[model samples]
Target: MFSIFKTFFWLGWISFGGPAAHIGYFRHTFVDKLGWLDDQEYAQLVALSQFLPGPGSSQVGFAIGYQRQGLLGAILAFIGFTLPSVLIMLCLALLSHKFNQSPLFEGVVHGLKLLAVVVVADATWGMYKSFCKQKLTSGLCLLTAAALLLIPSISTQIILLLFAALIGCKYLASNQSNTHQRFTPSIWPLITFGLLIFALPLMTSGLPLIKLFSDFFQAGSLVFGGGHVVLPLLQNIVGEQISQDAFLTGYAAAQAVPGPMFTFATYIGYQLIPQAPIAGALVATLGVFLPGFLLLLGVLKHWQHLAHVPKVSGALNGVNAAVVGLLLSALYQPVFTSAVLNPSDLVFVLVGFYLLKQLQLPIISIVISFILLGVASNWIV
Candidate 1:
């Protein structure tokens, strides 16, 4: 447990770029370096995390912890992975104004956006290779990608609901006999946590209610897709109440830093209510992440039985494919929309993608180069 915490702590401090980059770091550190889980198991965990809700990277972290040391480890891993971003975001919130003006800060953020593009592309490719090899699955992937591109404003929850219904229908239609058992849906934890989160606002007062409920609920809710997907839900909840500039600025800054992007909540929370920075940060961070943690705990507690269910596994497979498509969509709307504003930005993005996909250069190096380029460009132009 201690080692898990320490490992997560280090990752939280230095794991930057975005969800894709964080996955790469996890593959290198946990899979290659630590030998925590074999490749197949890791892939399964990745697939499972994508199928569930919440921040994909942080869920992956929780999955890793669960695989090694059970539920306790999962909790510890989440804490480790989450703490650095919360602390740093709080500090950044305190220095929000100056941080925004710093040329170096702008450069780092610029470079980081490019890095984010590469990371998302790479992750899409990786998932494609892993799960979309079958013709039917590959076709589904393309279809889903097209759907997302055409309807960018649709909430991911709706898409997921449609997919789940389709999977259920298909399962009911199939007559083929199989050894896999049916998974009984466990509603207790989901129900209990849901009630707790909703009741939280009533349990407290002032900023405390907002902070506690937001963080705890966000953390407990199972919101799959990735970090960018969390934005709409979060913004809908907190946008009207807080300074839009500060909220967005902190979010942009999250891209420039390491660890999970969900940590942006910490920055936004602190900035929204500075007098209670710690409490606010905690609330925001937890609110954004709580769902994933609760879902994982529920799943892990029943995975042995759930894994035997053919329909459940099949549905998860479809969801995983959709997740890949979702990531691809994100690369366009938020990421590409922001990063490639000019010819120069296009050049940097192309170079970064080439380095990552072709030359297999380290993502950190690409991020650094782009930051320097941004700084130099700002000086010259």
Candidate 2:
């Protein structure tokens, strides 16, 4: 358990390139290196995490830890992965102004953004290869991708819920002819939990309410892609009051730190109520991650029963494909738009992608190489 904690801590601090990148790192370290889980189990966990809220990478980390050492392991893993980002975000909140003005910082962030795009692209391909074997699954993948790319207004949650419902209906209709009864568990607990989470913030006041609503909403309601998707939602909510420079700076700083991207909330929260930095950070972090934990518990409790239904599994397969497509769509927006500003930047992106895909290099190495290149470019011209 201690060793797992230490390992998780190290991973939290070093993990970068967003959730997709984090997934690759997790697989490399846990599955490929440690042999903790086989490919199928790991993929299943990934699917499960995506279906739940919060940061997908953090949940994946928790699940991996749970598989290895039960509940205690899960707790330790969550702590280890979360602590570094919390600490760094708090510190950055305090130094927001100075950090934003630094050219080296901007350059590093620019390079990291490019690397993030490549990482997600690589991960999406890898997942597609693994899960898109069946014709139905492949069709779902293509359909979801097209829908996401074409439909700008529709959110991922609605898409997933609709897909899940279709699966449920299909299963019920198919089983209508069979005499064997498959017990459908009451969903009252899930309903109750959802209501409680949504209502909890309303009962609070001032900063507490802000924290509660922000965190709870993030953890429970918002679900687009992964950790990266949280940025815009948070920016819109908090940016109304906070300075744009502060928010953007903190976001860039977030990339430099390790742990879940949700920890960026800690920075925003602390800056919002710096008089009580710890309280602010804690509230923000918990608010963002709480839903994820609760949702995971609910799913784990009922996943076995759900998995037995082929239609349910089929829908999940489709949703998973859609997620990959969603990720692909994002690559062109903020990532490519912001990062590839110059010829040199383009060169760096290609080099980074090559190192990641062809060379199969570690993320840390790619990060370091890009950082050095950024620094060198700045100094040269």
Give the per-residue lDDT of model 2 (tens digit) for 52-107.
Answer: 66677888888888778977888899999899889878877776666655778666
TM-score of candidate 1 on Cα atoms, chains taken together: 0.77
Q: Which stretches of candidate 1 lie over 4 Å from their true place?
A: 1-7, 13-53, 154-195, 205-211, 214-248, 251-256, 271-275, 342-367
State which candidate has the highest lDDT: 1
Model 1 weakest lDDT span, ten residues long: 168-177
Q: Give the residue spans of candidate 2 off by over 4 A.
A: 152-157, 160-258, 342-346, 353-363
RMSD of each: 4.4, 4.7
lDDT of 1 by residue, 93-159 (tens): 8877777678776766666666666666666676677767666567666767777778764465356
What's the residue-level lDDT of 183 in candidate 1? 52
